[model samples]
Target chain A: NGTLVVAEHTNEKLVPITLNTITAASKLGEVTCLVAGSQCAKVAEEISKVQGVKKILLADNEVYKGFLPESLTPLLVAAQNQFKFTHILAGATAMGKSLIPRVAAKLDVSPVSDIIGINDTDTFVRTIYAGNAIQTVKSKDSVKLITVRGTAFEAAQVEGGSGATEQAPTVDVKNELSEFVSQELTKSDRPELTSARTVVSGGRGMKNGDNFKLLYDLADKMNAAVGASRAAVDAGFVPNDMQVGQTGKIVAPDLYIAVGISGAIQHLAGMKDSKVIVAINKDPEAPIFQVADYGLVADLFKAVPEMTDAMNK
Target chain B: MNPFDEIAVEEAVRMKEKKLATEIVAISCGPQQCQETLRTALAMGVDRAIHVLVDPKDYEGLQPIHVSKIIANAAKEEKADIVLLGKQAIDDDCNQTGQMTAALLDWPQATFASKVEKTNGDLQVIREIDGGLETIKVKVPAVLTADLRLNEPRYATLPNIMKAKKKPLASKKPSDYGVDMTPRQEIVSVEDPPVRQAGQKVENVDDLVGKLKDAGLV
Candidate 1:
C-alpha cells in the first residue's frame, strides 16, 4: 500500500508544511506527492528531491490557483481513483484543515486530524480537549485520511534520490460554487511563527496594543517572532495571526519567552514543546512558571526592557 | 451550543432583521440535552428548531463523517437555503463538520468566517486564514462556518424566552434520515499529557538573563 502526500505550495514556492507532511508520509509507505496548482512544474521538481518521495503527481491548472477546497477535492478524488492509495496525508495547515475534511466526507470516511504521532498503520496519537488529554485512535476505514501536526515531525531533507514526476489525471473544474475576492496578509520579515527558532509572546497583561510594541522591540533585538496568548488576541491587543495557543498557531521554538502570560492551559498546549521556556510575570504563582526552565517574578513593564537591554549588551 | 455557533445564529438574526432572510431554522444533532441548545437558539430570534435526536451513548465516539451526513439529511429535508455552523466545536476541536456537510450536499462552503454580510442575494464572507484574512463571495444556499471575531451574540431576554416556548421545535431520529451513526475510528486509549516539572524562580532580570546565558539561549 502506498501513501499520497498532498503538497501545499504558494504559487511561488512550496510551503514548509509539505516537507513535514512528506516526513510523516514516509513513515507509512512509499510516498507519492500530489502537487496541484497553476504553474507548479517547478514546485513538483523541488518535491521530487525530498528524501522519501518516490513519485510526484503533478496537476497544473488555472482553476486551482487559489487554495480553494472546492477545486482541490475533485482533483484528489481523481488522483485516488488512479493510484488506489491506501492512505492520504496532508499538513494540518489552514488549507489542509479546510480541504481534508471535505475530501474525507466525499470518500465517505472519517479523518484523524492534527495527529502528533503515528504509532502504526492503523493507530495514531492526537491531542484532544485543547491538549489537556491525549488520545490514541485506530481507524477501521480502508482508506485512512490524516492531517499531521507539522510541529510534531521533522522536515524531510531536500537533497535525495530523484523521484519520477507524472501528469495527474485531470477533473472538470467548472462547477465552482464560490469565487475568491481579496486577501489581507501580515507582511513580516521575521520568521513564521510555526518554524521560528525563538518566540517572544505577550498576554493580556500587556494592557493594550501600544504595549505590544515593547514585545516587537524585544523580538527585533533577538531576531525572534512575536506571539500572543489568546487573551491578548481576544482583548484586541494583537491580531489573531499572532495568537499562540490551542485556537491559534502551535509552535515549538528553540527558546520561548512568555511575558505577562498567566499561562492558560490552552496557551501552554501550543508552546510546551519549546526547547527552553522562560517566564516573566509579576505573579509568583503564575502557571507559566510551572513549565518554565527559568522563572522571574517581576513586573513585565520593567523586566522586559531590562532583559532586552541585557541581551543587547 | 458553542460560542461560535451562537455568533452564527446572531448573524442569521441580523440577516433576518435586514430582510435578507425570511425565517431562521436552527438545527443540531446530539443527545436529549441538545434540545435545550436548540431552544436557546429559538429564544435568540430563530424561527424554529430541528433536533436530529440520538442517544448520547450511541453518538459518543461518532466521527465527523456521520455528523455531516445527518446534517446534510436535515438540510435536504428542510430545503435550507443556507447552513451556518461554528467553525469547530470547542469540545472535540475537529473543525470538520461544516466543510464535510457542504461537500456531502455538493454545495459551496466558506469556513472560518470572521465577518459575514448579505449583499444582493450573495454572501460575502471574510475568512480568518492561516496568516491573514481572505474574503470570498458565495451564492446563497451555501455553508458558512463562524469564527471568533464574527459578532457578539445577544442575550435572550425573559420575554423572548417566554415567546420561544411557543415556537415550533421538531425532533427526528438519525435513522429517520437513513443515516448510519457508527463511528469510523476506534479509541485505543485516552491519557493525560506529560506533566512539566516545576522550575526554579529567579530574583530579578539579572538572574533571569544569567540563566538564559548559562543555557546558551542568548
Candidate 2:
C-alpha cells in the first residue's frame, strides 16, 4: 500500500531526478524515501522537505559509498521485507538502472524500466522501438519495481510538507566481491544535460572536436547545457557522456536547439519531448527540421554566432 | 544478437585470444530463431552455444526476471567463472538481465562497462555513468555488462559462419532450467508516439530567436 523511493544523492546534495521520481512515487501511494550513503544525513534532511514524502529512512554506512549493486541491493531487499512496500521506485539514471534490477531479481519480481506514464498502479505507458511506438504495460508482480524517466514527470516541489525521519533497519554491509576504485566525472559548471532548462546540441556536421566550441559559445549565451548527437560522439568530436539519443541520456528541456544534427530516430528518441525545438542546419531536408518548432536552414558556423549575438542584443 | 550483446561476445572472444580465459559459451533464451543469434556468437569465436528454446508465444511472455533465472541456472550448471552481457536488449530495451542474473546467483555485478582489464584474477572495470566514467574492481565470478564503447563487434565471416555450424549448439526448454516463463507485465496497447508537426520555417537567426522569445522559451 506504500511506495518506497530510493533517493539518489552524492552525500552533499540530492540529485534533482530524485524529485521527479518522488513525483511518480506519490502517484502510487504514500512515499518513504530511503537515503543510503556515508554521512548522508543532509540528503535525508533534503528529502524531508519535499512534499508527499511520508517518511525518510536514512541508512548511514561506509559500504554504501559507491552505491554498488552488491551492497545496495541487500539494503533495498531488507527495507522491502520490513516495510512491505507495494512499489519501489528510482530515477532511471545510471545508479538506478544498475541497482534496481538486482534488487528486483532478489525479490523475485520483474522490474519495468523508464516508465513515462502511469495508467494505474500496475499499468504504465512507455516508449519502445526507439520512441517509434508507445506501449501501455500492466505489471502483475506483487511488488512493482520501476525506474521513472525523470524528463517525463514534473519534479515534486522541494518545499511544502514535513516527513519524519527514522533509522532504517540494519543489514549486513560486508561486501567483499566489489571495490570502488575511482571515478572520472566531468566537472561542468553548466547545468547537467538531463535537468537543464535549455540544451544546445551538435552533431557530426560540427566536423571536429574543436568545432563543438561554437555550440558551447551559443549555449553559454542562453545558460544552456551542451549536448551532442551519437554521431558526434562516434566521430570522437565529443565524449559519449554528452550524447543524447535512445542509447544515451534522454533530455526534455524547455528549449532544445539542434545545430548540425540530422535528427536520427535515435537522437529524436532522446529530445523529441522538448517543449520548443529549434533546428539550424544547412540541409533543409534533414529529419531534424521535421520535428523542430522553428527551422533555420543556414550554415551553423554563421547562424550560431548570429543567434548568440542576437540573444546578447 | 542485440548490438550490445555482440560487443559482449566480442569482448569475450578478445579475452580468449589474450589467453585471459579458457572457454566462451554463448547463451540465449528465445524462440527457435534465437539459434541464429547463438550461431552469430559461435561464428565470432565462441567455443559453444546454449539455446533455451521457448515457443514464440511463450517467449513474448518472458521478462528479464525469468531470463535471468534461466541464465543463473545454466551458469550454476556450467560452473562458469563469470558472465558477460549487453547493457540492453534493443528490442525490449529492458537492460536488466545482467544485473538480475548476478543477483539471482548472488554474484557481483558491474554494468555499463566501457573498459575491462584482467589483473591477477580480478577484473578492473570502467563503467559509463551519467556524468562520466567510474572504475571499480570486482573479483572473478562477477557479471559485467558491455556498453557501446566496450569494443567493436567483429562481423561473422562466411568461413566462420560455415564453421559455426559444426560448433556444439544445445537447445533446452525453460522448464529444463526450472524457470517459469510467465508474463509479469501485460501490454495493454501499443500505438505510435505523438508526432511533432513541423512548425514555422524561420527566415534567419533573429526570426527564430523572436519566435522563441514570444513563446517565453528564451
Candidate 3:
C-alpha cells in the first residue's frame, strides 16, 4: 500500500497549479513527494507541507536542472526499487507529464491520465474524447503510475502537511544525448489556463476584440487566466491561445467564469472540467447554464463591466 | 494532403507557410496488429513507414513511454524535422507519448496543432486554444504532435493500398532501441465507467430544465 508522489520544483511561478501531486496523494497510500534538484531539500520542505504527504525523498543534483527524461527516468526507476510503491503519481504539467510515463516505462505499466475520480486505489475514471465521455480503467499491475489532470484537486491544500525526507544514491544518467538549451517563457504574468486556479472565459456573445478588454479586466481583477470558448475565438473576440474547447485546451480552474458563451457541445467539452462554473448569459437556458454551479440570466455586456468595476472598488 | 485536412486547417489557422516533407516516414509502435495504422498513414500521405514491433507476448500493457522512446529513437536516427502523432492513440487513450517523445529528443514540441507549415527556416503551428487560435512560429527542427483536427487522414485508396505493400515497413524490436518492456506498475483491473441512472425522457425542454436544476446543474 505504499504510494509515491513526484513534485515539480523551481522558480515558484507555476507551483500553485500543480494539483497532480496532491490529487495523486489523495488516492494512494503513504504518498512520498519526489524531488530532484539543488536546494531540493528546501523544495521538499515546502512540498511536504502540502496536506496528505507521508514522506519526501530529495535527490539534489545539479545535473537535474531543467529536465531530460533519459537522465531522470533512471532516478525514478531506482526509487521504485527502494520504495516498492504500488502507485507513482504526478501532475499533468510539463514536468510531471514528462516524468510519469518514464516511471511507467521503467515499471512497464500503463499510466492513466486526467482522471475525474479514483474508484478504489486500483481503479480510476477519466474523460476521453475531450470530456465527452468518461472511461473507467482498473490497473491489473501492482505498480501503477498516474498523471493527475492539473485541475481536479485544489493546490492551497498542500500548505500545511508533513513529510519525512530521505536521501538516495545518485543515478548514473546515460543518454546525455541532447544538450540543454535556454527556454523562452511567455512573459505574461496571467495564470496559464491549463493550471489556472480561477479563470474568466468568453464566447461569441462577447462580440469583438475590444469587448474582450472587459473580460481581460475582470480576469485581471480576479488574477485569473483569460480563456475563450471556440466561438469567441472564431469570431475574433480574442486570440487562439485563449481558446478552450474540444480541439483547443483542457482547463479545470477552481472558479470558471463563462460570459456570452452559449456552451456549444465542443466548448462545454473544454471548460466542463472546472471545479465551480459560473455562467452569465442573456438566455435563461443556455446549455452552459445546465453545467454551471451558478447561472446569471443577464447580458454579459451589462453584467461584466459592472462586475469588473465592482471588483475594482 | 487535402486542403481541408486536419494539418492543413492547422496551417491555415496559424498563418504559416507550408511545404511537403523532404521525405515523410511515418513511425509507429504497436502490437503486430498496429501495423495497420502504418499502412493507413502511408496510404494517407507519408512516403514510407517504420514499424517498431513489440514481442507478441509482451505487447499487452505496453506503455507510451516505451513507444515514445522507440519512436523518438527512430525519429532521432532519421534526423526528422517534425515528429507527428495523433494527440492520443485511439486504443490506450494515453496522450503523453508524443509530447514525452519531444522531451526525450530535447526538442521543442507543439501539441494540438490544427495546422503545420515550414517556411523560411521557421515552422508555424496553429494550436487551437480555448475560444480562439494562436499561431506560434518556432524555428525549424521541432516536433509537432497532431490532433484529430490537424488533418483528415486520407483513406488508403486501392492503388495506395497496393503501393503500401511495396513501401518499406521496417520492423524493429523494443530491445533494439534499449527500451525496457517490463511493467514497473501493473493494472490491478479495468472496467466500464459508472452508469448514469436511467431517467424518464422528459416531455419538454421545461421538464428537462426542471429536472436538470434539481440535479444542481442550474
Candidate 4:
C-alpha cells in the first residue's frame, strides 16, 4: 500500500510541516510526496532527504505557483487516479485546508481534517469544538483524504533518506476560476508562529501598538516568535496574522508566554496544546492562569523587561 | 450561528445595500435547531433561508461532502450568482464546505476572505493565509468564505427580528437534493482533551527564569 502526501513548499525550500506530515504519512504506508511548484527542484531534492519518504513525484509548472487550490486540485485527483493511492495527506495549514477539501470533493470521497492521531489505516483522532473535545473517527472512504495537524505529529528528519525522484504525469492544471493578484507576507526574522519553539504573546492589556515593543523585546531575548490575542488584533495593536485564537493560527509551541492577556476560551483553544504555558498577567483570576504551567502574577510592562534581562543574563 | 458565518451574512447584507447583490440567500445544514441560526441570518437581512434538515442522529453522520452537495444543489436551484459561507464551521471546524462546494459547482472559490470588493462584476478578495495575506480576483458564480476580519457583524434590531419571521424559510431533507448522508467515518469516541494542570506560580522574573532552566525550555 502507498500513501501520497501533497507536499507544502515554497519555490526554493520545503515547508517544515510537510516533514511532519511525512511522519504522519509514514505511519500509514510507503510514503511518496508530490512536490508541485515552479522551479521547485530544490524542494524535491529536500524531500528526497526526508527519512520516511520513499519517492518524490515532482511536478514543475508555472500554474502550480502560489499553490492555487483550483489548479492543484486537478493534479491531486489525477495523481490519485494514476497511482491508486489508498491515502492522500497534507499538512493542515492554510494551503492544505484550501486544497484538500476540493480534491476530496472531486474524488467523491470524504476529507478528514486536522487529525492528531492515527488509530489504524482507517481510524483517526481529531479535536472538535475548538479543542474542547477530542474525537476518534474511522474513515470508510475508499481513498482517505486527510490533513495532519503539524503540531500533533513529530517532524521526520530532513536528512538521511535515499528516495528516488520521478516526474509526475501531466494533468490539466489550467482553470478559469481564480487568478492570483498579489501577496503581502510578513518577513520576520523570528520563526513562524505555528512552528516556533517559544511564543511570547500580547493582548488588550498592552494598551496600544507601541506597547507591543515590550513583548517583542522579550520574544527576541527568548528567541521566540511574537504573537497577539484577538483582543489585541481587534484593538488595532497588531495585524491579524499575529492573532492566536480559535479563528486565527493554532500554535502548540514548547513555551507559550501570555503577557497582559486574559485567556478567553477561544484564545485558550489556540495555545492550550502548548507543552509549557506561562502567563504574566496582573489579574490572578484571569482564565489564563488556570492553564499556565508557570503563572507569574505581575505587571507585564515591568515584568517582561525584567524577564528579558534575566534571560539575557 | 457560527461567528464566521455571521460575518458572511453581514457581508451579504452589505453587498445588498451597496446594490452589488440583488438577493442574499442563507443555507444551514443541521438538526431542526439549525432553524434558529437561519432565523438569525434572516434577521441579519438575508433575503431568504434554506434549512437542509437532518435529524440529530444523522447530523453527526453528515460530513462536508454531503453538505457541499446539498449546498451545490441549492445554488443550482436558486440560480445564485455568488455563494457566501464561513471559512470553517465553528462546531466541526471542517473548513471544507466552501472549497468542496466550489469544486462541485465548478466555480471559483476564495476561502478565508478578509476583504471582498465588487469591481465590474468581478470580486477582489483578500484572503488570510499562513504567513500573511493574499489577494485574488474571481468572477461571479463564485464561493467566498468569510474570515474574521471581513466585518464586524451588526446586531439585529428588534424590528428586523420581527420582520425575519415573515422571511421565506424552507426546510428540505438531504434526499431531496439526491445526497446520500451515509457517513464516511465512524466516530469511535469523543472525550475531553487532556487538561493541563496549573503548575507553580513564580513570584518574579528570576524565579521564572530558574523554572525555565529547570524545565530545560531555555
Candidate 5:
C-alpha cells in the first residue's frame, strides 16, 4: 500500500517541487520516489536521501529526456503494472500538469489535481473558482492518481535517509506523435517563485517594464524572487512566466511583498498562502489590503524606492 | 461556450480565412444550450456544428477522460487533420482534455499555445511553459490548445448571425460514439474557503518596514 511519487527534475538536479511532492506522498503511506529521465541516476541518488522516501525506482532512457507526456504515460502505466501500487502522485508543476491526466485516463481512473490537503488515502481537498471555493473529492477507483499543489505542503528534508535504490524494468513505448524541439527559458540567479523564501511582486501599477527595476533591486537586497500579477503581464510589463495568480504560478513564500498591486481575486489565489503578506498600493480600497498582514497606502513610485533604500541601509 | 474554446474557434476561422484550411467544423458535448454556443462559432465563420447531446444534469460530473473520449471519436468520424480546444474550461479547470484527446487519438499535441503559425505544412506552436515560452513544431493532424493571449475573439455581426441560422447543425448522442459517461471520482463536499482575517494599516514606508522587521520578515 505504498505510494509512488513521480519525481520532477532537470537532468542535472532534482527540482524542489519533488521534495514537496514527497512530503505529500508520505501522508498517504510509505513513499517510493520514481526518477524517470535519461541518465537520472544522480537524481535517484539524491531522492534516496529525502527523509520520508523508502525506495527509489530509477528509469533511465533517452526517450524520457524531454518529459513528454506521450512517452512518460506509457512508462507510468508499465510501472503501475509491475508495482501494483495503490497511489501515484506528482507535484502540480508544468510537467505534472501535462503528464498526470493522460496517465489517469490511460489507467481508466479519475485524477484528483492541485490538491491542498489529504483527509485519507482516498479523500483529498482542492480549490476551485480561483480559490473562492474548496472541494473535497473522494476517489472510488482502486488506484488513485493525484497532483499535489506544491505551495500547500511543506518540503521534506533532503537529508538523513537511506532509502534503497533499484532499477525499474525498461518499457519501450514509442510515441511518434510528438517530438521535443527547443526551449527558451529565462535563466535567473534568484530563487524560483513557488519555492522562494521571500518574493517581491509587481502589478500593473508598475507602469512599465522599466519600472520593474525597482523591484529587481529590492529583490536582490532580500535574495527574493520577482513575480507579477496578470495585469502586469498582460500590460507587457513582464513576461507571462513572471505572472503569479490563479492562471499562473501558485506561491507560498515565507515573506511576500506586493508592490503597487490592486490584488485581484485571481492574483490573491496564488499568493494568499504566504506566511507573511505586505501590500503596498495607492488605492486604500484595494482588495489586496484585506488579506495583507501589513497594509501601506501610498503611491508605489515613492514607497518602493524608499523601502529599497531602507532595506539597503 | 468557454472563452478559451471561443479563442480556439476564432483561431480555426482565421486559419480558414488565410487559406490554411478549407473547412472548420465546431463540435461540442453538452446540453441543448451548447447549440447557442456553437451558433456563435458558426457566425464567426465555422462551416458547421455537431452537437453531442446529453442532459445538462448528467454532464455535470463528467470528467475530462469521458469528454476526451467523445471528442476523439468525433475527430475520427470527421477525419480531422487538426483538433483545437481551449487549454482548460473555467468550470473544472482540469486542463487535460486536449492532451488526453491527443493520447486517445494517438496524435501529437501542443498545449497552452499562445501563438500558433502554419509554416510549410507543419504547425509552429509557441507555448507558455512554467516560467517562459517554448516553441515546438508538430506535424499536421495534431491537437493544439489555446491560451489567453492567443487572440481576442471577434464578435459575430447580426448579418453573420442570420446566416449562421442557415448553416448545417448535426445533433447526435454520446451513445453514438460508444463513450461511457460514468465518472470515476466523487465529490464529497464543496465549501467556501476560510475567510482571511482583517489587517492593520501602516502610515508610511517607515511604519511598514518597522512592522516587517518586527515580524522578522525583513
Candidate 6:
C-alpha cells in the first residue's frame, strides 16, 4: 500500500498534517511525505522520525510561493498517478478542505473529508450534526482521498530521522479563478483555539466591546483564547474572528467557559468539543447551561470578576 | 482593484488588455436557480458559466462533510484555474465548506478573499485573516472562498441577463461523478433550539454583583 502525506513546511512543532500523515500511514502502508515547499526538507526529515514515515518528496517550485492550490493541484494529481496510492491523506485544514477533492476529481474518484477516526482498512468514522453525531462509513471505492480532522487520533511522534526529499514536477496551470490577495491571522502567543486546553467565550449578553474585557481577563487568568457566541459577533460586540459557530472556528479544548451566553445551534457548533464546559449566565435555563458541566445562574459581571479573583488567589 | 471586484460589463468589453493572458470562467453549483448568482460575474464580464444542477433541498440534511464532497465533485468537472465560493452560504451558515473542499482536493485553500490580483505566474490573493489581511501568492488553479466584501455584486440588466442566458451551462449528475447523493449522516428533522427563560436585571452593578455572589455564581 502507498500513502502520500501533504506536510506543513512551517516547523518542527506538531501540526495536524504530521499527525494525520503518520496515523493514516501507520494504518495503510508505507508512509511518504510530499513536502510541498521551500525550507521544508528539514521539517520533512524530522517528520521521518515519526513511527511510520518511510520517505519524503519535496515539490518546491517558485510557482508554489504560497499555498497555491492551482499549482499544487496539478502536482498532487501527478503524484497520485505516479505513486498509485491506495489512500491520500491530509489535514482537515483550509488547504485540506479546499484542495484534495481536485486530486480525487483528476483521478475520477470521490474524496471523503473531515473523517475523525479509522475503523478498519476501508471503514472510517466521522462526526455529523456539528460533532453531535458520529457516523462510521465504509468506502466501496478502491482508492480513497480524505481530510482527517486533527482530534481524531493521537499525533505522530517526532524524532530525529532523515528521509529523502525529491522535487515534484510542476503543473501547467491554465485559468485561475482568483489570485492570492492577503491573509490576517489572529495573533495569540497562547496555543491556537482548536488545540488549546481551555477557552473562555462571551455572548451578546456581554453587551458591547468593552465587556469582552471581562472574558479576556478570565481567559488571561486561565491562559485561554477569548471566544464569542455567534450573536455576539453578529451583533457587532466583537469581530467575526472571535465568533464561534458552524461557520467559524471549531475548537475542542479541555475546558470551555460560557459567560453571558445564550447558546444557539449556530454557536454550539464551534465549542461543543470541550471536555468540561462551565456556563455562567443570568438565566439558569440558557441553552448554554444544557451542555455545560457546571451551570451558574448569576450576573456575569460579578461571577467573572470573582472567578478571576479566585483563580488569581 | 480585484479583477473580481465590481466586475462590470466593462472588463469583458475592454478585453484587449495585453496584460490579461487568459479569459476567466465562473463556476457555481447548486440547484437550477444558482445561475442567478452568475449574473454579477456575467455583468462584470465572465467568459462563460459552469452550472451543476443539484437539488438544494438535498443539502438540508447533509452535514459539512457531505457538502464538501458535493462541492469537490462539481468543481472537478469545471477545469477552471480556481474555485471560489462564499465563505459561508447565508442559508446553511456553514463556514467550513471552503476549507473542507480544499481538503478533499489536496490543494491549498484560502478563505475570506477580499482582493485578488494576478502577477508573475501566481495569483495575488488578499485573504482576510484574524487582524488584517495577508497577501498570499498561489499559482493559478487554487480554491479561493469569497467574503461579502470581495465584491459589490452588480445587478444584471435585462440585456446582460439575456446575454448570460447565451453562456454555456453544463449539468453533471452526481452519480456520473461516482458521488453518492445519499447523505452519509442524514438528519431526520429540524427544529428551533431550546430557549432561555427571562432573567432578572439588577438595578446597579453592585446589586447585580452582590446578587450573583449570593447566588453562588461568584
Report the C-alpha displacement of residue A261, candidate 2, in angstroms: 0.7
Please write out the lDDT profile of model 4 over residues B1-218, one tens digit for every residue: 88888999999999999988898888888888889999999998998998988978888788889899999999999999999998998778889999999999999999999999987778999999888899998978899999988999999999999999999999889889999888888889999999889887988889999999998998
Candidate 2 C-alpha error for residue A211, in Å: 0.9
TM-scores for every candidate against the unseen true structure: 0.97, 0.98, 0.68, 0.98, 0.96, 0.68
**lDDT value for candidate 4?**
0.91
Residue-wise lDDT of candidate 6 within A49-126, one digit each (tens)? 776677777765455555556666778888877778788888766566556755665565556667766766677776
Q: Root-mean-square deviation of each candidate, in angstroms? A: 1.4, 1.1, 7.2, 1.2, 1.6, 7.7
- lDDT assessment of candidate 5: 0.89
Ranking by lDDT: 2, 4, 1, 5, 3, 6
Which of candidates 3 and 5 reaches a greater lDDT? 5
Model 1 misses residue B134 by how many Å? Answer: 0.9
Measured over the true interface residues after superposition, the C-alpha RMSD of each candidate is 1.0, 1.0, 7.9, 0.9, 1.2, 7.2
The candidate with the higher lDDT, 1 or 3, is 1
lDDT of 1 by residue, A1-313 (tens): 5999999988667899889888998889999999998888999999988899999999988888777898899999998888889899999877888999999999998998999999999999999988989999999998999999999999999997599999998788764587778888889988889988999999988999999888888888888999999899889898888989887888999999999999999899899989999999998889999999889898999989988899888
lDDT of 2: 0.92
lDDT of 1 at B136: 86
Least accurate stretch of 10 residues (summed lDDT) in model 2 chain A? A212-221
Residue-level lDDT of model 2, residues B1-218, one tens digit each, is 78899999999999999998799999998888899999999999999999999878987777888889999999999999889999998877788999999999999988999999988889999999998899999998999999999999999999999999999999899999998887888988999899899987999888888888888887
Q: What is the C-alpha lDDT profile of model 5 across B1-218, one tens digit per residue?
A: 78889999999999998898889999988888989999999999999999999867668778887889889999999999999999887766778888788878877788888999887878888888886888777878999999878888999999999999999999999889999887677899999898887589999989888888888888
lDDT of 3 by residue, B1-218 (tens): 31222353233223322344557776666677757766766665566777888877667657676778787888778987766665665444566776667667766556666666665666666654332345565545666666545654444589978887778888878888888877533554454433323123233334433543465433
Better of 2 and 4 by DockQ: 4
- Order the candidate numbers by DockQ, best to worst: 4, 2, 1, 5, 3, 6
- For candidate 5, give the lDDT of residue A230: 92
Residue-level error in angstroms, candidate 6, position B33:
10
- TM-score, chain A only, candidate 5, equals 0.98
lDDT of 2 by residue, A1-313 (tens): 5999999999989999999999999999999999999999999998899999989999999998888889888899999999899999999999999989999998989999999999899999888888889988999989999999999999999998799999998998899999999989988889899999999999988999998888888888899999999999888898878999998999999999999999999999999999989999999899999999999999999999899888887
Q: CA lDDT of B178 in candidate 6?
A: 65
| Candidate number achieving the greatest lDDT relative to the actual structure | 2
Alpha carbon deviation, residue B154, candidate 1 (Å)? 1.5
